[model samples]
Target: MTHQTADATDHPTVAALVARSNRLGGDPRNTNYAGGNTSAKGTAPDPVTGQDIELLWVKGSGGDLGTLQPKGLAVLRLDRMRALADVYPGLDREDEMVAAFDYCLHGKGGAAPSIDTAMHGLVDAPHVDHLHPDSGIALATAADGEALTREIFGDQVVWVPWRRPGFQLGLDIAAIKAKNPQAIGCILGGHGITAWGDTSEECEERSLDIIRRAEDFIVSRAASRDAHPFGPQRPGYEPLPDDERRARAAALAPVIRGLASFDAPQVGHFTDSSVVLDFLARERLLPLAELGTSCPDHFLRTKVKPLVVDVPTSATVEETVTALRAAHAAYRADYAAYYERGAAAARARGEEPPAMRGADPTIVLVPGVGMFSYGRNKQTARVAGEFYVNAINVMRGAETISTYAPIAEDEKFRIEYWALEEAKLQRMPAPKPLAMRVALVTGAASGIGKAIATRLAAEGACVVVADLDLAKATAAAAELGSADVAIGIAMDVSSEAAVQAGLREAVLAFGGVDLVVNNAGLSLSRSLFETTEADWDLQHNVMAKGSFLVSREAARVLVDQGLGGDIVYISSKNSVFAGPNNIAYSATKADQAHQVRLLAAELGEHGIRVNGVNPDGVVRGSGIFASGWGANRAAVYGVPEEKLGEFYAQRTLLKREVLPENVAAAVFALCSSDFSHTTGLHVPVDAGVAAAFLR
Candidate 1:
């Protein structure tokens, strides 16, 4: 990686471009300089670009992007790039410039495109970027980067071996893009790649995505092979002195936020608990999992790693967390101290953290100590920090074989920062294949929603009941409790935050999230004219918008877990076939059905299936259904309670008003592996209302 050279007149611009390249801001941050180069080819197109969709301008290569000048940007005719790709099907390092040139860039109008132009010309994105980041390098070193990439990103991204730069890489980009018109880019293993998007920001976002994925993969591998810390399966803990507990919490709180995640309460509680304390204090409770981060993208979900600390019972949670609170800050302070101390200690010593200093730490395994990471996002924190408690145990058994040594810091950083490597993270949005195996149900209270949730739970899923009625969700959970069954969450589906919070807790509790039943809904029997707007909104908010919020978050978790998921919308027959003069009740349910269809397409690649069920009038009694059918029908049709069943049932071919339990059965079917491929379609519970009517 030598520095770029520049012509005298282009010195200033070249310097600026060189600086930009070296800053290492976006994708390929830590591992770039050779993957891809930017060269502005010609002037802007005649049309003005729209907002949020800027024409991310790239200067063509005069010298190189590493030291490109405004003039260095060839502004060449893009036509050449396009033509070149079409002509050169077998481009490679040996291809002559003119011979490969025709095969690389083509004429858009009559203009000659840049040599690396095919990539810039053909991509259908607003922004196109090419980089070789550091993390990619680390990932590639293991020789399993490709498999790992496919596992995490699904089918959105493409991974290719390193090809020679210039025309060869350019042709490869065009070929891949032609086949996957919707593709972002591909990883150029040893070389680099060219990526495109609808906009520059989008391009940057995609770049970030690639690096993160690569980082996550490599880190995971490093952790798996190396033995650093050995911790227990269950965190060991015991009561700690109050002073120590509070002290630990206070000390670790801020660092935890930066390195673990937002859930301070859970972290503090877990750390302070007797179980965790005992585990941390145990001399042998080394790193359980030397968690290498998935990638910088995972940074958003998991900080770096957990501080797997082992402390004596005397060391309260507060004391330990609190004491460690100053650790990060102290570390930062120490970096400066080390830098200054080095000035006095020795000039040759690198003044930086061990990680940055080119010293690959197999994590500092303090015998009785717990694990930790550099940032928040605790999920990753635990992964990053746990020095593979497993590795520790294995090593203990293998002490006779040989001691372990962490990879070198420079190598680690090289892998961490490589660009050609990070492109894997920027892959497309699709569901991982893993999520299909698991399912979760909530509001297993009773009636329609409960029936659906419970059904899934019974089908070998680790069912967890979540509802506003904690007792009810709990009772339902208890009744179904088994090897795979779990507990209940007292959540009010009506509240946006509550639903999200509950679902998140479930995701963390369970390793992943797959099926979500947006089944908790209520129907008020007030007639059309009598319903207030507020009442209508309340109903819609829960039945419609609530589902929206829940499905959105659920999809994210599902995608992250690299597993497919399912969402079942429980509707009423009233949604499609008009029921009386009722407006609010029917309208909201209809909205629910529509929403399901739309989300199905959006989440399809993620393998998240969305479907709807329109159950008929469910018979109710004095229990959870006290107000189930309160008067709307009796008021409109002026029908007596005695003849309601006869009136409603007579309309159906089966002559039966669908029961709450029956609706639940439909929901259960829609959400399980039974309907793994079904989505975007709505099924009616009304026996033959629509089916019987050939008219």
Candidate 2:
């Protein structure tokens, strides 16, 4: 897709539109992570006809307004779109309309236009901004939302009742505009706000000003009254003490995440941010919080209503999990019933309802703790969390001003199953293999561990970089990518206490572990006669003892979470193909080889698989080489240390250099379902080393 430069040198209209769109997109109060759309209409050179034609530059589907560039906006011939609207005048045939939208594209290398293009095109203005603003939706979805809008803005804005957004909504907008020519904007009931102006700045300023007015109305009323926002007003409940609330949230996150994973193997992410915590702390508002989302636009992200569970006041993990699982089952059953009811209502109205969506609750509300959001991946979870936060804010504001009310149940169903939203979802890429799973890699500061961690994160798994050096681990995690994808922690695997504490920290940070890579090791090339006791002790502690400690601790968590998991050890080829002067390293690796088999036998019943990878002559970026063991290894082979990598590569049957990435690939394969049926097996990533082949 072509990206428009944010340069001010473009046509004044495009430049102004880009500037204002970016400004609105940048602020969460206006737009969330790519949640809103912006557009501008102006005359542009028509390629087909040597004439200036009215064209609409609108935010493309999936484009983030905050970082929008010129290429991010699709340009369409307004005359063509307006005419197409007349062709399908009475009702919306969604697929046909979307295809027609694609056929009207006038810009080169632009992404797909947003489904809301019709509404923007129908609004006769130089600039239009449509956003799911919290304050705006608060006033739009209130019990007396129309009255509130009239009282707050009077004829300044028009109220458009809830309609599934499509060609029909565009027609309604046009009709509304024709009657209320002086209105600056229109509030879509249980949806969002759409504002227009003769110029880009005027439209943007008007939108912001309207939102500010709503904010003021809510705040002023809240300060005047002691009653809850939603009535039959209940007495205000004091918040839980900070320490107890934090402790409760921490203890309950894993259980909630685990329960959310009911049928899935991967536990989802959690959002215990201060906003969520404060909302949860208000014990009296728990009932209202379970009502539903603030606006219908949030339906796709958070479902109809969050599944509410009892506050884990002083509960144990086992107790919480049991309660949560029961609550989750009940929630799913209720969701199924709710859908059936909506479907029956649609049929009773003589309208065929769309297909049913998944019954799982995306947002889970725990009264005493905090809210938790679930998604197939981290980004989805974050986006859902953001929408829920906005919902909470809007609900609070509306309640403080007047009784809070979302759209009716039937409208929720229509919005949640809107064909336009479904089409957008259909365009998304299929999820990767490691999506949503969490992996922990010890000694991830560099080499094989680093490669494994990076690969896992790239494949969509959240990674934990555990290393003895916190600084190096932190830097390494940063390099892997976003903080949501990976985190770095300090841990010396050889220390039992450190390993235990590190696992606890990891569990709290990422919900629970689904995969563990036991890769920490120390190398020494001392012959049996020359091997020192210290060398033997150190090698065994890190390689054998360390892997065991990590494996045992990780197993405990996986068992507790009750989700099947994978554990892979990065043992050495030396364990299978012993060479001269490698006594300490070889023996410890052999110990790990046997350890993997024994642990696999023990963990199989718990649904935890154990495996190992034996990598030979990964000398190029070997931590062993960095520690000066390459010279000692080269001395044994009668070659220069610098040539050892080449020597090993040439000696292998494949004559290929076995890099750290190759070993990481093997670890990933063993961890994934590719080798799911087999455990206690050690795969060799040594470019086909004949001597290292297991018998």
lDDT tens digits, residues 1-695, model 2? 23432222386777878899889988888866777788988876655555677888888888888988887888788889888866883663553686788777774626687778888888777788888888888887788888889999999898898776777787788788778988988888877888888988899998898878888988898889975554332223223466665555556665666677775644455666766655665544557666787565576788878887663445555676677889889988988898898888868866676777567678887654566787777667767878888888888877777667787787787666666677777878987889879899999989889999989988879999999899999999999887778889999999999998788767766777889999988788787888999999999999899999999988877876777889999988888996888888999999999999999999999788999999987787778687879888889888998889899999989998889899889988987877879889999888888888998
Clashes of each: 156, 7
Q: What are the per-model C-alpha RMSD values against the true structure?
A: 20.6, 3.3
lDDT of each: 0.49, 0.80
Per-residue lDDT of model 1, residues 1-695, tens digit only: 23222222344433443344434332224332222454322233232231111122344432333444344443333444455455554532223443444333211222222334545655544346665454443333224446655675665677765443445655566677778765666765433334555544455556667767765654565457554333333334544465644433433332343222222211111123333344355444443223332222222122222234344445544565554444434444543443344343322432222222211121222112323232112232343333233222222322212222223323233334323223322332343222223344544577666666556655545555877788887777788764234567777777777876676556433334557777767766666677888879888887787778777767766664434567878766777777666688788888988898899889898777889887666655312234646455655567776566566678788888766667767766776556778999787787768632322
Best by lDDT: 2
Cα-based TM-score, every candidate:
0.42, 0.92
Instruction: Report lDDT (Cα) of residue 190, candidate 1.
Output: 37
What value of lDDT does candidate 2 attain over all alpha carbons?
0.80
Cα-based lDDT at residue 161, candidate 2:
86
TM-score result, candidate 2 = 0.92
